[model samples]
Target chain A: MSFDVNQLFDVNQLFAEICEEDNLFAFEGTITSEEINTILENVEARMAELQIDLKHRKKIYNITVECIQNLYHHSDMVPEPLVEKLGKNYGQFVLRRPGNGYFITVGNFVLNEKIKFLSEKIDKLNSLSSDELKEMYKFILNYQKLSSKGGGGLGLIDIVRKSEHKLMYRFYPYNDDYCFYRLDIVI
Target chain B: MDTLSIEGTAKTPTVRFDASKGLIELKGRSIPENSIEFYKPLVEWLESYAKEAKSQSTVNIQLEYFNTSSSKCILDIFKRLEAIHKNGSEVAINWFYDEDDEDMLEAGQDYESIIRVPFRMMEVAAG
Candidate 1:
């Protein structure tokens, strides 16, 4: 089945649907440099409206950027013929105002085989204390050689450590070959 | 000896390293898309600064959050500073963390414990 690159993702509609009032200003869209910038700006503006202080603002901004970049770099979606021709992957990000903090959700397609490894890693990270997480991060950073993207399980650890909150995750079956994984970090 | 200043972005930190003044400061968040590309020049500047460094040198790091890649880069910087300190020069590293940020404080301690240099971890009020 041939899918047109531009037709594969409706970024605007996705954003609108996810940003509804019921979602508490949550938004979802494709992963692009421009989109990333917009998300940062919007989150900052929302933080201002919510009277979030500058320090927490910095933390939220940093964590959000890291999560978005992770999706952009590691999301399981390989370029389809049309996407490759257009030079982009179809990714989504969602943000919502939850409790005393904001929750950022990111979703992307990935290979079926990767889900098990990712789930295991997330489970392990979720179970570790802050101290254990730091030790784990150090161990990974020291022993793990640099990959092409410089990731060696430390990014996820950093995300969990910085958030200081539990990670919420869900997996949706897309097809036999690909599944969509959604991860949320509250800051 | 020269100074290098790069503005911080949403995914990166501000870098100010003045070789002549022997003052290096890194602040803000760092999760750069291309960690190596962003840090290579800073590493190069430190390499040059280590040789031309006259007088006591002080490097201050005030970071709120950094990804794993930046963590490695931070370690690299500390190693360079340690080398300079070993070459019969004065070097002091002041690592500042938010008062409520125990994770950062512990991270600073981790770095301090690993590198053989005069390192001070300070807890400052969050801004």
Candidate 2:
């Protein structure tokens, strides 16, 4: 799983390029608990400054919380090859106003082996109707054990539920052993 | 027993639990990164309070937003209240939501459906 960071394009550069259209904020690096708090505060302040309605602000804020927490957990699963250069829990996120609604895009490096599992999870969530998703959320909340990181496997489901939109994602292969995972959430 | 009063933070909620009057109040947002860690003391308080339970218990939950992990911890809190109710004390759970937040209302309903304890969904104007 050893590969030079030069083989793939710089993650920060990629984020900057894609987020040029009305990007509110784009951040790349380690995402720790402290960072999550700061990010949430910033998002809230920015949305409030725009005078977004309470309902929409709450929705966007909740979605952002789940997205950043997901990144905090999954981003740590970085491939061994890039660990030195990227560091643990390396992640990036962009929040922007692309059009009528807000969009949140989060990216992280992950092992290739996890790509299938993550893809299937999102696809299954996208396939279900709102009611079904609610049921699934309740089922997991009642039965699943929270991981050491305090994740109950309900982050993605909560994101889809709040957004009321299909979950969109992409996995760009960095090498045979690792892939840069990007998830797009519309709110 | 000692009363539990914790001021809310950016990531946690304000908690006010009084065993003498059997009153519990949880207000503000609950989006802690580690919900269990933040809620363990409160949960432990509930367990001990359940033993010498009062005749009537009133619980008020007012939350702006809670992450998935907090949601699970919330359910655990409800279950503990349900036990107290099943053991012969009267327990009333008031779940307050913003007037326009259907999701919060539904979340309260979902918890009511699962836990045997009675719940009153109160709609409040968004502040």
Candidate 3:
């Protein structure tokens, strides 16, 4: 099966649906650290308008930071077949309000071979109880060495733990050699 | 030794470590893309301070939030402070969070359990 957006996906329809979701912000294509910072500032300013308490505001903000950072850490160049349509390391992230809480959804490219490993990883994290999650977080914090990207593979753990909710995700085949890894966190 | 202070930014935290006064503080959000780079000086300062730290050193951490990358750097800071505590100086880590921020309190508890230094979780009234 192929995952070519030009034929298999409708970019305009997807973008239009995203627009109707009460989006606070959405960024497509290349995302850098500086760009992430700018988006964080924009989200913070928008959340401030809600006049909610500070604690919740900080949670949503922090989760948003982690979500966007995923782009920098996990984004892969689109497969050659899809490169012209998707560009290199191009991803889509949206912060929106669909229900009582905010939703942070991000979709980034990953090499197709990585899908199984990532799938099991997220599933393992999702299956743990809250206490187990805490233990895993500590174990990782103390024992696991930092990766080249400066993460101990704990971002998802921290995100899931903070939101105290499930880490919802999906994997869409973007091409023969790439997959679209989509993650959604509600806070 | 002189005091060390760095202003906070949208991506990094503010640090105030007064060597003579035995007071160390880190406040604000820490989500820098390269937290190791941002926090290298603070860690190095603490390493030097541990050599001749005062008899009683109080470290205050009032982070609104920090990313996972910053979490490791924060742990590094505590581990260095642990050296100071083990070296015979009385060290107290005061972790402050908004009254309603249970997650922040839990974060403090996690660090307290991990590090040997004394940790005081101070809850400020929510605004």
Task: Give candidate 2 misplaced runs (Cα > 4 Å).
Answer: A1-9, A79-85
Model 2 chain A is weakest, by summed lDDT over 10 consecutive residues, at A1-10
How far in Å is the alpha carbon of B116 misplaced in model 2?
A: 0.9
Native-referenced DockQ of model 2: 0.81
Residue B1 of model 2: what lDDT? 96
Model 3 TM-score on a 0 to 1 scale? 0.93
Candidate closest to the true structure, highest TM-score: 2
- Top-lDDT structure, candidate number: 2
TM-score of each: 0.82, 0.94, 0.93
Supply the global lDDT for candidate 2. Answer: 0.88
How far in Å is the alpha carbon of A163 misplaced in model 1? 2.5
lDDT agreement with native, every candidate: 0.74, 0.88, 0.82
Give one digit per residue, the lDDT tens place, for model 1 in A39-80: 777877887887876656666766776777777677537436
lDDT for model 3, on a 0 to 1 scale? Answer: 0.82
Instruction: Place model 3 in a CAPRI quality band.
Output: medium
Better of 1 and 3 by TM-score: 3
- Candidate 1 — which residues are off by over 4 angstroms? A1-25, A53-58, A76-87, A150-152, B7-11, B98-103, B123-127
Ranking by DockQ: 2, 3, 1
Fnat of all models, as shown: 0.37, 0.74, 0.58
